[model samples]
Target: MAAAVEDFAPREIVSSRGARITVRAVRPEDEDGFHAAFLRLSSESRYTRFMSVVRDLSEATLHHATHPDATREFALVAVAGDQIVAGGRFVAVPETSDCEFAVTVVDDWQGHGLGRALLTALRDAAAVRGYGRMEGYVLSTNLAMRKLGARLGFSDGPMPGDATTRLLVVVLRGDDGRAAGG
Candidate 1:
């Protein structure tokens, strides 16, 4: 089932540099803006996020990104006026209460705390959907992301079969207690 657009609430926050940005769910109508944001990413940023050198997003990738399956996937975008400055998402792991997530912020917007905000929103949304944990693979050289993961309470370890990346996982909390994997 697809998650209704209204399922995610929009939030307004002031960045570290004092710019007000809105964070909300990614909608089908955001394809153009999303693509534009991808274009604005620096080559290194793209490589860090995708774990490879990706100069452009393919048609199918764009479609899947903007049209998330509500039951097993969730995505959000941070907008500064008409521009998408950052985005994040989580896809559920089959037969498990965990989801793998990814996040990216535009080069100009880096260090403004937008990435952290987007990630927090993603975590909250996933918990609401009953996901007990969220994880992601970060390039070993991306120290900023590793720090952010630590700040967000995620534990990290070497990714099996990949020396260039590390796996970070955060156990979500539920009403009863810590989520399943915790």
Candidate 2:
């Protein structure tokens, strides 16, 4: 059965640097924090994550990020005190057993393992929803993200018709037994 939104209660984790952090489902109340985190991302980070030179998060993007549908869309955020340090999410692909996933960590928090935690949470959430796989389109030049995805069991190949992009996928276990992430 698909897990409900309430199933994703807040949980705490310690980063590689030993900083305490909380990981939880993104809530409507997180709008301001999300905005702040977006603003704090470096231009290169923004471009790599969004595939564009986004100067700011638009209202539409904020809504999509914060107001995820409990079933088909799920999002997670990692917080240290009052600030969002990282975020991850997966959205079900229509008419398919796969979902698209994404993850981002604040500039100052990139090397702390928060990305792994956030993605793990996302993968668990998607599994409960019966998704068979999770995937993302990453920039071919983004070696850091590619490396992270590889560590999480994702396999990648060049995105057809787009030499600058690659598709990364991780199989998630379904009833038939397959294997899922952020």
Candidate 3:
């Protein structure tokens, strides 16, 4: 069974620094807040997240981010008051029990456990959605994300044909918390 948007309810959480934040599903009305969060990211953070130097998000990109397909994709944002402090999402791979995941935290919010919170939620949601595996591409030099992924049970390896990038993967199923043949 597929999870609905409503499955992602707003829940308050405390960051590692003890800052209170609410995690919830992204909404169309959050476009401005989302954009504002993007703007708060430093150039290095933007490049690491997008794999490119993105000064701004295009209209189509914003639309897609704000309006994820409930059946094949899920997204969540961590809000600290009116500001979107971080966000994460997963997109199903066509005809496969695999999904691609991504996460981003504003410069000021990094290292405060927002990435862990968001990624853990995404992993659990993907498993509930019946996906057997979750993975993401992270720049090899981004040691912070690599370390975080390792802590969350995601294994890292070289991306074929792309040495500068690392492929991070985690099995979402199996009694041991890792599916076979993944």
Candidate 4:
């Protein structure tokens, strides 16, 4: 069997709300918030984001997504009013330094800039760690996400065979004024 990679948990730094949410590193303490965030996800939003129904997300599943090791993964959560309303992750491809990313914001929080913040945070974090680029496959129906990606420097193409999806990639140069990492 292959050696297991370390799991990553986001460290809460702070929220734009001025409320303290640590983005420093993820810990076991985040399990509950992680679960609740997924549970609270509306079915439609879940489908939109995950490209699946997301009928149920067990604790193990949540842990797998939220708690990857910092070396291969970087994740962040957005919290306000004692709940994690948003979060994101970037998974480093083993064979290369590039990464793939996804961001989520609870339905009520949609259009509230939380998604943008989460993406910016993850992109900067990836760049700092020496990732030269990042990309994602988003459903074509998710014009909002596509638009957000475009605003953040993503370009689009057909997701080969799955016409409903669009693939996009962007380079993340360190010191690039484009990222919110500073």
Candidate 5:
């Protein structure tokens, strides 16, 4: 596992359509804004991100989202003005040098490159942590994600026993010029 990283420097990025957004690690004070962003997501947007119909985030899930374990998990948020516009995270897989990633952009921010920015951050962070691989499970109908995954060098295939889901994976190399896990 990687060492605890309490925070990261904030970065400013321009969306494809020229919107300025700041990307930063999630903080405790972001809970309310994060929830508001979720509420603003259309039902279809929510379903695509969650792969299920989630009207609201559970208290436990909300807390966990805002408070990632410093050692094995990293979460980030993209903010425009005072509101959250996107978020992403990667959680280490137990006993393995691999991480599972998830990313979501609010409906209005979709198709504007926020998701790409967050996913890139997660992938780079995991690589820096010496993770061997990063993987994501996306719904089969999510063509945007599939295309993004492909463009980012992630290979995708059907998830075992899940017809509606596809698993995307990319091997990561560490500073030593070798594949991370083995």
Candidate 6:
């Protein structure tokens, strides 16, 4: 029997600001777009999304991230004009009941609503997959993500990383969109 999750087709979504534009989900043929979008992110933006300084990516990470799948590991891609501007993921981790999330929008797209849209898309996807919770870790310095978390109903908490360096973005009850603390 087909898993219920397979029935969900992530529809393409687009968000535009003035002459700028964005679209959701990368195509299998858009590897270069994926690579370029990733490279456009500032180091800090990358750190906030990946939770550390991403020295670089190995081939495996790139392939798995771009391949469209019905499983818990899914991605939402965003584009602006000729630029592949941003992306995020709703990832399934088998060891926990909760799914995890990460988003990266290039510097230019930061202040706009892209992050929130990507996050909302990821959160809704999690709910569809029967996940009642999601958790994320953001560097303490990345205030935008921290604030976005609060707006999206994520509870704030300290991360186990260096005392002043990391903070955890947690949404305790993923279903209700309530503020959940560490």
Q: For residues 1-81, write the lDDT of model 2, one tens digit per residue.
A: 344566788998999999999998898988989999999999999999999889998888898788888767888899999
Candidate 1 clash figure, as a count: 0
State how far residue 20 of model 4 sits from its true place (Å). Answer: 8.4
Model 6 residue 131 lDDT? 67
Distance (Å) between predicted and true CA of 118, model 2?
0.9
Runs in model 3 deviating more than 4 A are: 175-182
User: Which candidate leads in lDDT?
Assistant: 3
Tell me which residue pairs clash in candidate 2: 172-179, 172-180, 173-179
Give the Å error, residue 109, model 6: 1.6
Which candidate, 4 or 5, has the higher lDDT? 5
Of candidate 5, the 10-residue stretch with the lowest lDDT total is 1-10
Residue range 38-115, candidate 1, lDDT tens digits = 999999999999989999988899999999877778889999989999999989898877889999999999999998
CA-lDDT, candidates in order = 0.88, 0.87, 0.90, 0.73, 0.88, 0.68
By lDDT, the better pick of 1 and 2 is 1
Candidate 2, number of clashes = 3
TM-score per candidate, chains pooled? 0.92, 0.92, 0.93, 0.81, 0.92, 0.77
Candidate 3 per-residue C-alpha lDDT over 1-182 given as tens digits, one digit per residue, 9 for 90 to 100: 36566687788999999999999999999888989999899999999999998899987888889988888889999999889999999998888778999999999899999999999999888887778889999999999999989999999999889899999999888656464444
lDDT of 6 by residue, 38-116 (tens): 7877787777677668967777777877775555576777766666777887666676657778888888877778888
Candidate 5 whole-model C-alpha lDDT, 0 to 1:
0.88
**lDDT (Cα, 0-100) at 151 in candidate 3:** 93
* Candidate 2 global TM-score: 0.92
What stretches of model 1 exceed 4 Å from their correct place?
1-5, 173-182
Cα RMSD, each candidate:
2.5, 2.5, 2.6, 5.1, 2.5, 4.4
Q: What digit string (tens of lDDT, one per residue) describes model 4 on residues 5-41? A: 2323444444444555544334457788878888888
